[model samples]
Target chain A: MNDSKFPPNTNRVAEHIVGLPKSGIRDFFELVNAMDDVISLGIGEPDFMTPWHIREASIYALENGHTSYTSNLGLLSLRKEICRYVKSNYAVEYDPVSECIVTVGVSEGLDLLLRAIINPGDEIIYHEPCYVSYAPGIQMAHGIPVVVPTYEKNDFALDPADLKKAITPKSKAILLNFPCNPTGATMPLDKLKEVAQIAIDNDILVIADEIYSELTYEGEHISIASLPGMRERTIFLHGFSKAYAMTGYRIAYACGPVDIIDAMMNIHQYSMLCAPINGQEAALEALRNGKTEMMRMKYEYRDRRNVITKRLNEMGLKCFKPVGAFYVFPNITSSGLSSNEFATRLLNEQNVAVVPGGAFGKCGEGFVRCAYAASIDNIVEAMDRIALFLKR
Target chain B: MKNNILRLLRKNARLSVENIAEQVSSDVATVQKIISELEDENVIRGYQAVIDESKLSELQVKAIIEVHIQPQRDGGFDNIARRLANFAEVNSLYLVSGGYDLQLEVQGESLQEVAGFVSSKLATIEGVTATATHFILKKYKEAGRLFEDGAEYERLKVSP
Candidate 1:
């Protein structure tokens, strides 16, 4: 074939596709790595390794020659274990065979759902400041992302009134993430009920990302799926990454009505055959026998959460007391700088890393997010540097 | 008299409290107290001098960073968010409800600066699995003010 024989390239990459950038935490780490000495409190991943047993299970799967691709819906054993775990822990039910599909990660599950359900001009109601992908993914799927801005004073809780206001005739779905990422905020059961009622009345689907359901520090983590009439309407996304610290393994699953699951499965079948075979085995093992490890990690996180909350409050940062997640979203508007200005100065001057709130959405401009997944020593050191930086 | 004085002061932030009081027939203490309250409530967030950045010609790059994270066990994302909340470079961070778990706004002088921050700093963290960055092109409207105000169309017409 002649070189340059292919049709001349004309169209730019689809207008909806967005590129992923390096995370702010990664940027901060680069600075830390180059410096003589630095402490970092950025990023929200667990510092602990995947439990030894979970690792061993993956090893066992590999050794037993379970490397081939499993069913598109994922390995039966893992899905069954997920069903048990969800029912026992979250009070939600799913049939492993027909209503669930294994995904590369929650990320992939999100992509699949958006692709499967969204039509051009569909409205996606979501909370903000939210996980970054919801809006962009909606945009890419040719959907409009209507953000319901949660307030820091309200502990980042969603307001039913706001949700009502954001709804329109075109509204297709509402995305909920309890035990949320940056804010570490969880929806109370009553709020979840109210949200469910709203979703039901509006005939909207509820895409609930409960990947962090197991990391709650307060009252029980309530799944929207468990609410009355919500199981039929809500698509639950969960994964072994956060609970098992298996982020690198990229194993997650989604469960909803058969139609939605089938649609998502179509996307999964075309894009990714299945989650890694080893990851599926590891996730199954973790679900079955990792409760103690999960509890231990949760307690350690609680200790770190307490220390950081107290210390930051002492340092003049007004932080909403987080109930479930390990993050603390504080109001930095009082600091006399924009969230971006504060974060940049802190990293450049104090060698500390953090993400600015505005990156989440316009409503998030006044605050910053701090991840305390680091050790006590790193948190303490980073806080001291922050104190000094603030003093200066 | 009071209304007129209030209008005058509203028109000019540089007017001293004493100057406003003199015009309004009020005491300086009263004027000072009102201004103080406004500042405290952040109705007037802060005073700023509009700098001519062209003199320095520094690079102004804005990027949106999407972060995926798992909430820490027991403590959830609170522990992780608080640690990130203190950094200077982070303008804002949000726990969003979609594909990427967290969204962050970062401002830097160059793309390299942002990329460096992401790869060396953010990706290395434990909870963050992947990040996607979107660089802002032109801010058409920010804080409710239109930037170009239909000028681009006019410019294109003239050029063509």
Candidate 2:
């Protein structure tokens, strides 16, 4: 049905929903899905399967007639495990009873937190190139998204100075994703300390999406909440998606001060009610016994990271070696094409698909994110094809 | 580092030295030296493909034979095990505890040939007290690969 038949003012859709821009990634994805024999280096999730034991736990849960809805705050046992995990990994403490609530995934957790906290027109400061969801998520929650550009010169690390400059009196929270997506950048601890101090000084809350923390290849991923004077003001979001290779399970959790967590849970109970019980059971198994497989996959990603980064640089893509995450954000400026142009031509000519960095934000205009989650052979072949594409 | 190299090779032995070096995060020279050292020390005995002989047109037979042997005064079962290991038909040999003294995986062109080996050669050996052979009927999985289900990447071609 062509919409041109309708009068100009006859539309009945919500103004905000209609005004929202379509996702750039979605447009590129349609083109990719229509093609055949494309080697994708664009997906953000893990290539590994969910470990058998975790899958078996969910199977067991289903077989034992555990199909009912869990508590509004999620299963008590799963929440307790999540708390313990947070305590050990982030060196922060929280009461499992009041301060934790399981959501569908980090995606839902972020949405819940934003809707719970954001007053209309409140500003959320985030760094870019970033995950594509942050700006739109904030906008959907009726908050304004303020972006600070992180450059390749600094290895895409968020500069606290710029972050400080972006904050305003209307700023409600700072959304931080260390070991970030689209850039594969992690904030330095000292910089994190500075950012935490700035937030404390301004009395702003922090919404930390640390979904990729476990895949850190460097020393360790430092949670901003762990810093002094930050725990009471930070919302920590993590999930079984990236680290556990359980993206399809849709199990993640949020932990914060009782008041904020209660607010998020209020929204959660009204809408999602609770995360799926089977996914929670699977996540419980993952938290308990999934370390070995998790580490194996992490090591594999690290290996692929090394090979791909080296190959990209050798082929004149000028990639920065990301210290964590399974992606290499290679600068494609040498090819004299915009990120989208390069991605389109490479896909059409060589059947190697990569996400244009511009999909993340404007700061990502000249580069493309090449996920190293693929097999080494595929990554090597993709690099070769990309090289050939550049040559031609 | 050695273990890491071996792990990559275990998955795919055909990787070039440069590929191995990149995967292991080492230079080619260092990887080359380490691989040569491993070869010299016999840590890497050989590289062979994992094959399912059942796929071939020619019919093949395989059997796991349990051998109960009497131990010599000084040599124990080592003398008999060494003698059995030299046979070309013996694919694998292990000295297992329990009812059986030694277990052997023997392969042949046919069931008759394998049965003949057990009767004429294995049973005739000194201190070979008893033998029981179990024939393998089919191959489902070999060397960490499934014959029926190959892993296909079912995820979307591109995502954010």
DockQ list for all candidates: 0.01, 0.85
Q: Which stretches of candidate 1 lie over 4 Å from their true place?
A: A1-11, A18-36, B1-160
Choose the strongest candidate by lDDT. Answer: 2
- Which candidate number has the best TM-score? 2
Residues A1-392, model 2: lDDT tens digits: 35786766766767766667678677789999888899999888898889899999999999999999999999999889999999999999999999999999999999999999999999999999998889989988988999999999999999989998998999999999988898889888899999999999999999999999999987988899999999999999999999999999999999999999999999999999999999999999999999999998998998899899889999899978888877789999999999999999999899999999999899999999999989999999998999889898
**Per-residue accuracy of model 1 over A1-392 as CA lDDT, tens digit each:** 33475554534445455243324444444444465444555565776779989999889888999889999899998888888777888787889999988899898999999989999989999998877778878887788888899988678889888899998999999999888877888887787788899999999999999888888876788888988899999999999887788877999999889999999999888889888898898998898899899987886676567667766887888896677766888888667999878988987898787778876677888888887777756776787888888788
Q: In lDDT terms, how accurate is model 2?
A: 0.92
Error of 2 at A111 (Å): 0.2
Residue B145, model 1: lDDT of: 39
Off by over 4 Å in 2: A1-11, B97-99, B150-154
Residue B86, model 2, lDDT: 99
lDDT of 2 by residue, B1-160 (tens): 8988998988898999999999888999999999999999999999899887876899889999999999999899999999999999999999998999999999999999999999999999999999999999987887777778666765688888
Clash counts for all predictions: 76, 0
Candidate 1 lDDT score at position A46? 73
Looking at candidate 2, what is the lDDT of residue A55? 97
